[model samples]
Target chain A: MAVRVQREAFDIGAEIDRLRAGRTSVGAVASFMGVMRDFNDGSGVQSMVLEHYPGMTERALESIVAEAGERWPLIDTLVVHRVGELRPSDPIVLVVTLSAHREAALAACAFIMDFLKTRAPFWKKERTPAGERWVEARASDDRAADRWQEGDGA
Target chain B: METAHGSVRVLYFARLREAFGTSGETMDLAPGLCTVADLRERLALRGGVWAEELAGSRVVRFAVNQTLCPPAHALSAGDEIAVFPPVTGG
Candidate 1:
Protein backbone atom coordinates (compact mmCIF):
# COMPACT_ATOMS: atom_id res chain seq x y z
CA MET A 1 0.00 0.00 0.00
CA ALA A 2 1.14 3.55 -0.79
CA VAL A 3 -0.14 7.11 -0.35
CA ARG A 4 1.34 10.16 -2.01
CA VAL A 5 0.42 13.82 -1.77
CA GLN A 6 2.31 15.93 -4.28
CA ARG A 7 2.00 18.88 -6.67
CA GLU A 8 3.50 17.06 -9.67
CA ALA A 9 1.15 15.31 -12.04
CA PHE A 10 1.47 11.52 -12.28
CA ASP A 11 1.33 9.25 -15.30
CA ILE A 12 -1.69 6.97 -14.89
CA GLY A 13 -0.46 4.31 -17.30
CA ALA A 14 2.90 4.09 -15.55
CA GLU A 15 1.18 3.81 -12.18
CA ILE A 16 -0.99 0.96 -13.44
CA ASP A 17 1.93 -0.76 -15.07
CA ARG A 18 3.95 -0.65 -11.88
CA LEU A 19 1.14 -2.50 -10.09
CA ARG A 20 0.73 -5.04 -12.83
CA ALA A 21 4.42 -5.84 -13.23
CA GLY A 22 5.85 -8.69 -11.12
CA ARG A 23 2.44 -9.42 -9.65
CA THR A 24 0.91 -12.52 -11.10
CA SER A 25 -1.40 -13.08 -8.12
CA VAL A 26 -3.33 -9.94 -8.96
CA GLY A 27 -6.40 -10.83 -10.97
CA ALA A 28 -8.08 -7.40 -11.11
CA VAL A 29 -7.22 -3.76 -10.65
CA ALA A 30 -9.93 -1.21 -9.96
CA SER A 31 -9.17 2.49 -10.12
CA PHE A 32 -10.83 5.88 -9.88
CA MET A 33 -9.61 9.36 -10.79
CA GLY A 34 -11.16 12.60 -9.57
CA VAL A 35 -10.85 15.71 -11.74
CA MET A 36 -11.41 19.40 -11.22
CA ARG A 37 -14.62 20.62 -12.78
CA ASP A 38 -15.21 23.83 -14.72
CA PHE A 39 -18.15 24.73 -12.50
CA ASN A 40 -19.41 24.06 -9.02
CA ASP A 41 -22.43 25.26 -7.06
CA GLY A 42 -23.80 26.84 -10.25
CA SER A 43 -20.81 29.15 -10.77
CA GLY A 44 -18.02 29.04 -13.35
CA VAL A 45 -14.69 28.03 -11.83
CA GLN A 46 -11.47 29.27 -13.35
CA SER A 47 -9.07 27.58 -10.98
CA MET A 48 -8.78 25.86 -7.63
CA VAL A 49 -6.30 25.73 -4.77
CA LEU A 50 -6.10 22.68 -2.52
CA GLU A 51 -4.68 23.01 0.99
CA HIS A 52 -3.79 20.21 3.37
CA TYR A 53 -2.11 19.63 6.70
CA PRO A 54 1.14 18.04 5.64
CA GLY A 55 1.91 15.54 8.40
CA MET A 56 -1.69 14.91 9.31
CA THR A 57 -2.95 14.40 5.76
CA GLU A 58 -0.56 11.53 5.12
CA ARG A 59 -1.39 9.85 8.41
CA ALA A 60 -5.13 10.15 7.79
CA LEU A 61 -4.81 8.66 4.30
CA GLU A 62 -2.71 5.79 5.56
CA SER A 63 -5.30 5.02 8.18
CA ILE A 64 -8.06 5.06 5.57
CA VAL A 65 -6.18 2.60 3.39
CA ALA A 66 -5.44 0.45 6.39
CA GLU A 67 -9.09 0.33 7.25
CA ALA A 68 -9.83 -0.88 3.73
CA GLY A 69 -7.19 -3.53 4.12
CA GLU A 70 -8.78 -4.77 7.32
CA ARG A 71 -12.24 -5.04 5.79
CA TRP A 72 -11.39 -6.40 2.38
CA PRO A 73 -9.31 -9.18 0.87
CA LEU A 74 -6.80 -7.06 -1.02
CA ILE A 75 -3.38 -7.46 -2.50
CA ASP A 76 -2.38 -3.82 -2.83
CA THR A 77 -3.62 -0.23 -2.87
CA LEU A 78 -2.36 3.13 -4.07
CA VAL A 79 -3.65 6.65 -3.40
CA VAL A 80 -2.34 9.86 -4.90
CA HIS A 81 -3.76 13.28 -4.11
CA ARG A 82 -2.66 16.60 -5.65
CA VAL A 83 -2.25 19.88 -3.86
CA GLY A 84 -1.56 23.54 -4.68
CA GLU A 85 -3.15 25.31 -7.68
CA LEU A 86 -5.02 23.43 -10.40
CA ARG A 87 -7.38 24.14 -13.28
CA PRO A 88 -10.41 22.47 -14.80
CA SER A 89 -9.75 18.98 -16.23
CA ASP A 90 -6.79 18.62 -13.92
CA PRO A 91 -6.79 15.38 -12.01
CA ILE A 92 -7.27 15.91 -8.31
CA VAL A 93 -7.08 12.43 -6.83
CA LEU A 94 -6.46 8.80 -7.76
CA VAL A 95 -7.28 5.47 -6.07
CA VAL A 96 -6.22 2.03 -7.21
CA THR A 97 -7.00 -1.28 -5.52
CA LEU A 98 -5.78 -4.71 -6.50
CA SER A 99 -7.22 -8.07 -5.50
CA ALA A 100 -7.49 -11.68 -6.56
CA HIS A 101 -11.18 -11.15 -7.41
CA ARG A 102 -12.95 -8.35 -9.17
CA GLU A 103 -15.54 -7.93 -6.42
CA ALA A 104 -13.02 -7.16 -3.65
CA ALA A 105 -11.02 -4.86 -5.90
CA LEU A 106 -14.07 -2.91 -7.04
CA ALA A 107 -15.66 -2.65 -3.62
CA ALA A 108 -12.41 -1.61 -1.95
CA CYS A 109 -11.85 1.07 -4.59
CA ALA A 110 -15.27 2.59 -3.94
CA PHE A 111 -14.79 2.32 -0.18
CA ILE A 112 -11.47 4.16 -0.34
CA MET A 113 -12.97 6.91 -2.46
CA ASP A 114 -15.92 7.31 -0.13
CA PHE A 115 -13.74 7.47 2.97
CA LEU A 116 -11.26 9.82 1.33
CA LYS A 117 -14.03 12.25 0.44
CA THR A 118 -15.01 12.76 4.08
CA ARG A 119 -12.13 11.62 6.29
CA ALA A 120 -9.20 13.31 4.56
CA PRO A 121 -8.07 16.72 5.80
CA PHE A 122 -7.58 18.43 2.43
CA TRP A 123 -9.64 21.54 1.67
CA LYS A 124 -10.43 23.27 -1.61
CA LYS A 125 -10.94 26.89 -2.60
CA GLU A 126 -12.24 27.71 -6.07
CA ARG A 127 -11.73 30.88 -8.02
CA THR A 128 -15.20 31.33 -9.38
CA PRO A 129 -16.55 34.12 -11.56
CA ALA A 130 -18.17 35.53 -8.45
CA GLY A 131 -15.04 35.24 -6.33
CA GLU A 132 -12.78 32.79 -4.58
CA ARG A 133 -14.62 30.74 -1.97
CA TRP A 134 -13.82 27.69 0.13
CA VAL A 135 -15.76 24.67 -0.92
CA GLU A 136 -18.19 23.23 1.60
CA ALA A 137 -18.47 19.56 2.53
CA ARG A 138 -21.49 17.99 0.96
CA ALA A 139 -24.07 16.05 2.95
CA SER A 140 -24.09 13.49 0.18
CA ASP A 141 -20.50 12.63 1.00
CA ASP A 142 -21.39 12.08 4.64
CA ARG A 143 -24.23 9.85 3.58
CA ALA A 144 -21.96 7.85 1.33
CA ALA A 145 -19.41 7.29 4.07
CA ASP A 146 -22.14 6.41 6.53
CA ARG A 147 -23.30 3.55 4.34
CA TRP A 148 -20.00 1.79 4.94
CA GLN A 149 -20.66 1.73 8.64
CA GLU A 150 -23.87 -0.17 7.87
CA GLY A 151 -21.75 -2.89 6.29
CA ASP A 152 -22.44 -5.05 3.19
CA GLY A 153 -25.12 -7.04 5.00
CA ALA A 154 -27.67 -5.31 2.82
CA MET B 1 -7.94 20.89 43.28
CA GLU B 2 -4.96 22.63 41.74
CA THR B 3 -5.83 24.72 38.72
CA ALA B 4 -4.04 23.68 35.54
CA HIS B 5 -2.37 26.22 33.29
CA GLY B 6 -0.64 25.24 30.02
CA SER B 7 0.03 26.18 26.41
CA VAL B 8 -0.68 24.83 22.96
CA ARG B 9 0.29 25.66 19.40
CA VAL B 10 -2.82 26.50 17.41
CA LEU B 11 -2.84 26.16 13.64
CA TYR B 12 -5.34 27.53 11.16
CA PHE B 13 -6.11 26.65 7.56
CA ALA B 14 -7.98 27.77 4.45
CA ARG B 15 -10.64 30.33 5.34
CA LEU B 16 -9.58 30.41 8.95
CA ARG B 17 -6.07 31.35 7.92
CA GLU B 18 -7.42 34.06 5.63
CA ALA B 19 -9.65 35.41 8.38
CA PHE B 20 -7.05 35.23 11.17
CA GLY B 21 -4.29 36.69 8.97
CA THR B 22 -1.76 34.11 10.17
CA SER B 23 -1.05 30.42 9.83
CA GLY B 24 -0.76 29.67 13.52
CA GLU B 25 -0.06 31.01 16.99
CA THR B 26 1.15 29.74 20.34
CA MET B 27 -1.52 30.38 22.93
CA ASP B 28 -1.18 30.35 26.69
CA LEU B 29 -4.10 28.40 28.03
CA ALA B 30 -6.06 30.13 30.75
CA PRO B 31 -6.56 28.43 34.10
CA GLY B 32 -9.22 25.71 34.09
CA LEU B 33 -9.25 25.58 30.27
CA CYS B 34 -9.30 21.78 30.09
CA THR B 35 -11.13 20.95 26.89
CA VAL B 36 -11.06 21.83 23.20
CA ALA B 37 -14.38 23.62 23.66
CA ASP B 38 -12.90 25.72 26.44
CA LEU B 39 -9.99 26.73 24.25
CA ARG B 40 -12.36 27.66 21.45
CA GLU B 41 -14.45 29.83 23.75
CA ARG B 42 -11.35 31.57 25.01
CA LEU B 43 -10.22 32.33 21.48
CA ALA B 44 -13.68 33.57 20.58
CA LEU B 45 -13.28 36.16 23.33
CA ARG B 46 -11.19 38.05 20.79
CA GLY B 47 -14.56 39.05 19.37
CA GLY B 48 -15.34 40.31 15.86
CA VAL B 49 -14.11 37.84 13.28
CA TRP B 50 -13.04 35.30 15.88
CA ALA B 51 -16.47 35.35 17.45
CA GLU B 52 -18.30 35.08 14.17
CA GLU B 53 -16.15 32.35 12.68
CA LEU B 54 -16.30 30.16 15.77
CA ALA B 55 -19.95 30.61 16.56
CA GLY B 56 -21.75 27.46 17.70
CA SER B 57 -23.71 27.23 14.47
CA ARG B 58 -20.58 27.37 12.33
CA VAL B 59 -19.21 24.32 10.59
CA VAL B 60 -15.70 24.55 12.03
CA ARG B 61 -13.85 21.36 12.97
CA PHE B 62 -11.12 20.77 15.50
CA ALA B 63 -8.06 18.56 15.65
CA VAL B 64 -5.93 17.83 18.69
CA ASN B 65 -2.39 16.65 18.13
CA GLN B 66 -3.20 16.02 14.46
CA THR B 67 -6.21 13.87 15.21
CA LEU B 68 -9.79 14.94 14.59
CA CYS B 69 -11.29 15.56 18.00
CA PRO B 70 -14.62 16.46 19.49
CA PRO B 71 -15.16 19.65 21.45
CA ALA B 72 -15.13 17.66 24.70
CA HIS B 73 -11.67 16.24 24.06
CA ALA B 74 -9.20 17.13 26.76
CA LEU B 75 -6.29 19.48 26.16
CA SER B 76 -2.69 19.17 27.23
CA ALA B 77 0.41 21.28 27.38
CA GLY B 78 2.40 21.56 24.14
CA ASP B 79 -0.25 19.85 22.08
CA GLU B 80 -0.74 20.92 18.48
CA ILE B 81 -4.28 22.13 17.92
CA ALA B 82 -5.83 22.78 14.53
CA VAL B 83 -9.02 24.68 13.89
CA PHE B 84 -10.50 24.86 10.42
CA PRO B 85 -13.62 24.67 8.35
CA PRO B 86 -15.03 21.29 7.31
CA VAL B 87 -13.00 19.28 4.80
CA THR B 88 -13.89 19.39 1.08
CA GLY B 89 -11.56 16.99 -0.68
CA GLY B 90 -11.91 13.94 -2.90
Candidate 2:
Protein backbone atom coordinates (compact mmCIF):
# COMPACT_ATOMS: atom_id res chain seq x y z
CA MET A 1 0.00 0.00 0.00
CA ALA A 2 1.16 3.54 -0.82
CA VAL A 3 -0.33 6.86 0.25
CA ARG A 4 1.27 10.11 -0.82
CA VAL A 5 0.26 13.73 -0.30
CA GLN A 6 2.06 15.99 -2.71
CA ARG A 7 1.59 18.64 -5.37
CA GLU A 8 3.07 16.43 -8.10
CA ALA A 9 0.79 14.88 -10.68
CA PHE A 10 0.74 11.08 -10.71
CA ASP A 11 0.86 8.70 -13.66
CA ILE A 12 -1.77 6.00 -13.10
CA GLY A 13 -0.45 3.61 -15.72
CA ALA A 14 3.11 3.81 -14.47
CA GLU A 15 2.09 3.29 -10.88
CA ILE A 16 -0.11 0.33 -11.71
CA ASP A 17 2.62 -1.35 -13.73
CA ARG A 18 5.11 -0.90 -10.92
CA LEU A 19 2.68 -2.40 -8.44
CA ARG A 20 2.16 -5.52 -10.50
CA ALA A 21 5.92 -5.83 -11.29
CA GLY A 22 6.47 -9.48 -10.30
CA ARG A 23 3.13 -10.42 -8.91
CA THR A 24 1.32 -13.15 -10.77
CA SER A 25 -1.73 -13.72 -8.55
CA VAL A 26 -3.02 -10.26 -9.45
CA GLY A 27 -5.65 -10.70 -12.11
CA ALA A 28 -7.18 -7.21 -12.07
CA VAL A 29 -6.31 -3.54 -11.63
CA ALA A 30 -8.79 -0.76 -10.92
CA SER A 31 -8.37 2.92 -10.27
CA PHE A 32 -10.03 6.36 -9.91
CA MET A 33 -8.84 9.90 -10.56
CA GLY A 34 -10.40 13.10 -9.17
CA VAL A 35 -9.76 16.37 -10.94
CA MET A 36 -10.38 20.01 -10.18
CA ARG A 37 -13.51 21.31 -11.85
CA ASP A 38 -14.37 24.81 -12.97
CA PHE A 39 -17.73 24.98 -11.18
CA ASN A 40 -18.96 24.38 -7.70
CA ASP A 41 -22.45 24.86 -6.28
CA GLY A 42 -23.48 26.87 -9.35
CA SER A 43 -20.52 29.20 -8.96
CA GLY A 44 -18.01 29.62 -11.78
CA VAL A 45 -14.78 28.48 -10.25
CA GLN A 46 -11.47 29.78 -11.53
CA SER A 47 -9.08 27.80 -9.37
CA MET A 48 -8.84 25.92 -6.11
CA VAL A 49 -6.42 25.57 -3.21
CA LEU A 50 -6.37 22.46 -1.11
CA GLU A 51 -5.08 22.18 2.46
CA HIS A 52 -4.75 19.30 4.86
CA TYR A 53 -3.80 18.51 8.45
CA PRO A 54 -0.43 16.93 7.55
CA GLY A 55 0.09 14.09 9.98
CA MET A 56 -3.61 13.51 10.39
CA THR A 57 -4.27 13.29 6.66
CA GLU A 58 -1.75 10.52 6.14
CA ARG A 59 -3.03 8.61 9.15
CA ALA A 60 -6.59 8.85 7.88
CA LEU A 61 -5.65 7.52 4.45
CA GLU A 62 -3.65 4.72 6.01
CA SER A 63 -6.64 3.69 8.05
CA ILE A 64 -8.95 3.79 5.06
CA VAL A 65 -6.60 1.65 2.98
CA ALA A 66 -6.13 -0.76 5.85
CA GLU A 67 -9.88 -1.18 6.04
CA ALA A 68 -9.97 -1.96 2.34
CA GLY A 69 -7.24 -4.51 2.78
CA GLU A 70 -9.29 -6.28 5.41
CA ARG A 71 -12.28 -6.51 3.11
CA TRP A 72 -10.62 -7.58 -0.12
CA PRO A 73 -7.80 -9.82 -1.21
CA LEU A 74 -5.94 -6.81 -2.50
CA ILE A 75 -2.37 -7.18 -3.73
CA ASP A 76 -1.52 -3.48 -3.73
CA THR A 77 -3.10 -0.01 -3.42
CA LEU A 78 -2.13 3.62 -3.93
CA VAL A 79 -3.68 6.95 -2.94
CA VAL A 80 -2.15 10.21 -4.19
CA HIS A 81 -3.66 13.53 -3.13
CA ARG A 82 -2.45 16.96 -4.14
CA VAL A 83 -2.32 20.13 -2.12
CA GLY A 84 -1.68 23.83 -2.83
CA GLU A 85 -3.11 25.67 -5.83
CA LEU A 86 -4.64 23.91 -8.81
CA ARG A 87 -6.50 25.11 -11.86
CA PRO A 88 -9.51 23.65 -13.57
CA SER A 89 -8.88 20.25 -15.20
CA ASP A 90 -5.77 19.67 -13.08
CA PRO A 91 -5.51 16.22 -11.61
CA ILE A 92 -6.12 16.79 -7.92
CA VAL A 93 -6.12 13.25 -6.65
CA LEU A 94 -5.68 9.67 -7.80
CA VAL A 95 -6.36 6.26 -6.30
CA VAL A 96 -5.00 3.71 -8.69
CA THR A 97 -4.09 0.03 -8.80
CA LEU A 98 -5.97 -2.46 -6.76
CA SER A 99 -4.67 -5.93 -7.47
CA ALA A 100 -6.67 -9.06 -6.90
CA HIS A 101 -9.17 -11.10 -8.87
CA ARG A 102 -11.14 -8.85 -11.24
CA GLU A 103 -14.12 -8.65 -8.91
CA ALA A 104 -12.10 -7.85 -5.80
CA ALA A 105 -10.00 -5.23 -7.60
CA LEU A 106 -12.99 -3.32 -8.91
CA ALA A 107 -14.93 -3.42 -5.67
CA ALA A 108 -11.97 -2.35 -3.58
CA CYS A 109 -11.19 0.53 -5.88
CA ALA A 110 -14.73 1.93 -5.57
CA PHE A 111 -14.75 1.35 -1.84
CA ILE A 112 -11.50 3.29 -1.30
CA MET A 113 -12.70 6.34 -3.19
CA ASP A 114 -16.09 6.38 -1.47
CA PHE A 115 -14.47 6.14 1.95
CA LEU A 116 -11.96 8.87 1.12
CA LYS A 117 -14.60 11.30 -0.10
CA THR A 118 -16.16 11.54 3.34
CA ARG A 119 -13.38 10.54 5.72
CA ALA A 120 -10.28 12.29 4.39
CA PRO A 121 -9.04 15.37 6.25
CA PHE A 122 -8.49 17.64 3.29
CA TRP A 123 -10.37 20.84 2.41
CA LYS A 124 -10.66 22.97 -0.70
CA LYS A 125 -11.18 26.69 -1.17
CA GLU A 126 -12.44 27.66 -4.61
CA ARG A 127 -11.85 30.95 -6.36
CA THR A 128 -15.14 31.81 -7.96
CA PRO A 129 -16.56 34.84 -9.67
CA ALA A 130 -17.95 36.04 -6.37
CA GLY A 131 -14.86 35.26 -4.29
CA GLU A 132 -12.93 32.45 -2.72
CA ARG A 133 -15.41 30.23 -0.93
CA TRP A 134 -15.07 26.98 0.92
CA VAL A 135 -16.95 24.11 -0.62
CA GLU A 136 -19.41 22.32 1.60
CA ALA A 137 -19.73 18.55 1.89
CA ARG A 138 -22.45 17.20 -0.35
CA ALA A 139 -25.30 15.10 0.99
CA SER A 140 -24.42 12.67 -1.74
CA ASP A 141 -20.97 12.22 -0.25
CA ASP A 142 -22.46 11.50 3.15
CA ARG A 143 -24.71 8.87 1.62
CA ALA A 144 -21.80 7.34 -0.25
CA ALA A 145 -19.83 6.85 2.93
CA ASP A 146 -22.91 5.59 4.72
CA ARG A 147 -23.36 2.62 2.41
CA TRP A 148 -20.11 1.03 3.55
CA GLN A 149 -21.47 0.69 7.05
CA GLU A 150 -24.04 -1.85 5.84
CA GLY A 151 -22.21 -3.33 2.89
CA ASP A 152 -18.95 -4.38 4.45
CA GLY A 153 -17.45 -7.14 2.32
CA ALA A 154 -18.48 -10.44 3.85
CA MET B 1 -7.90 30.61 49.34
CA GLU B 2 -8.27 29.21 45.78
CA THR B 3 -6.09 26.97 43.66
CA ALA B 4 -5.24 28.02 40.11
CA HIS B 5 -6.86 26.11 37.25
CA GLY B 6 -5.84 26.31 33.61
CA SER B 7 -8.32 27.27 30.92
CA VAL B 8 -9.41 24.91 28.15
CA ARG B 9 -7.57 25.42 24.88
CA VAL B 10 -9.60 25.20 21.69
CA LEU B 11 -7.83 25.32 18.34
CA TYR B 12 -9.25 26.78 15.17
CA PHE B 13 -8.20 26.15 11.58
CA ALA B 14 -9.21 26.83 7.98
CA ARG B 15 -12.36 28.88 7.46
CA LEU B 16 -13.27 28.82 11.14
CA ARG B 17 -10.25 30.93 12.08
CA GLU B 18 -10.73 33.20 9.10
CA ALA B 19 -14.26 33.93 10.27
CA PHE B 20 -13.52 34.03 13.99
CA GLY B 21 -10.30 36.11 13.73
CA THR B 22 -8.38 34.00 16.23
CA SER B 23 -6.38 30.91 15.43
CA GLY B 24 -6.63 29.39 18.90
CA GLU B 25 -7.53 30.33 22.43
CA THR B 26 -7.62 29.14 25.98
CA MET B 27 -10.85 30.13 27.59
CA ASP B 28 -12.16 29.39 31.03
CA LEU B 29 -15.15 27.31 30.04
CA ALA B 30 -18.25 27.95 32.11
CA PRO B 31 -19.45 25.29 34.45
CA GLY B 32 -21.30 22.26 32.93
CA LEU B 33 -20.20 22.45 29.29
CA CYS B 34 -18.29 19.19 28.82
CA THR B 35 -18.91 18.02 25.30
CA VAL B 36 -18.22 19.38 21.82
CA ALA B 37 -21.79 20.59 21.19
CA ASP B 38 -22.01 22.22 24.61
CA LEU B 39 -18.82 24.12 23.98
CA ARG B 40 -20.18 25.36 20.67
CA GLU B 41 -23.28 26.77 22.32
CA ARG B 42 -21.24 28.55 24.94
CA LEU B 43 -18.83 29.91 22.36
CA ALA B 44 -21.72 31.03 20.17
CA LEU B 45 -23.02 33.02 23.10
CA ARG B 46 -19.93 35.25 22.78
CA GLY B 47 -22.25 37.43 20.72
CA GLY B 48 -21.65 39.75 17.78
CA VAL B 49 -20.05 38.13 14.73
CA TRP B 50 -19.58 34.83 16.51
CA ALA B 51 -23.30 34.60 17.17
CA GLU B 52 -24.00 34.91 13.49
CA GLU B 53 -21.28 32.60 12.25
CA LEU B 54 -21.88 29.68 14.58
CA ALA B 55 -25.53 30.19 15.30
CA GLY B 56 -28.16 27.55 14.64
CA SER B 57 -27.78 24.50 12.30
CA ARG B 58 -24.79 25.66 10.29
CA VAL B 59 -22.57 22.79 9.25
CA VAL B 60 -19.22 22.82 11.03
CA ARG B 61 -16.49 20.23 11.41
CA PHE B 62 -14.94 19.05 14.64
CA ALA B 63 -11.73 17.26 15.55
CA VAL B 64 -10.78 15.87 18.90
CA ASN B 65 -7.18 14.84 19.46
CA GLN B 66 -6.53 15.23 15.74
CA THR B 67 -9.26 12.84 14.71
CA LEU B 68 -12.52 13.80 13.01
CA CYS B 69 -15.18 13.75 15.67
CA PRO B 70 -18.86 14.38 16.13
CA PRO B 71 -20.43 16.98 18.39
CA ALA B 72 -21.25 14.25 20.85
CA HIS B 73 -17.57 13.65 21.56
CA ALA B 74 -16.97 14.21 25.26
CA LEU B 75 -14.47 16.76 26.47
CA SER B 76 -12.48 17.32 29.61
CA ALA B 77 -10.18 20.03 30.80
CA GLY B 78 -7.14 20.53 28.53
CA ASP B 79 -8.50 18.43 25.68
CA GLU B 80 -7.72 19.80 22.21
CA ILE B 81 -10.85 20.37 20.18
CA ALA B 82 -10.49 21.87 16.72
CA VAL B 83 -13.37 23.56 14.96
CA PHE B 84 -13.47 24.31 11.27
CA PRO B 85 -15.62 24.29 8.18
CA PRO B 86 -16.25 20.98 6.43
CA VAL B 87 -13.19 19.66 4.58
CA THR B 88 -13.03 20.09 0.79
CA GLY B 89 -9.32 19.50 0.13
CA GLY B 90 -8.10 16.89 -2.30
Q: How high is each candidate's TM-score?
A: 0.96, 0.88
Model 1, span A5-35: residue lDDT tens: 9998877778988977899999999999999
C-alpha lDDT of all candidate models, in order: 0.91, 0.81
TM-score result, candidate 1: 0.96
Please give, for residues A23-57, the per-residue lDDT of candidate 2 as tens digits.
88877888888988888787799998887877778
Number of the top lDDT candidate: 1
What lDDT would candidate 1 get against the real structure? 0.91
* Model 2, residue pairs in steric clash: A122-B89, A123-B88, A123-B89, A124-B88, A124-B89
User: DockQ for all models, in order?
Assistant: 0.83, 0.58
Top DockQ model: 1
- Docking category of candidate 2: medium
Model 2, runs deviating above 4 Å: A151-154, B1-8, B28-30
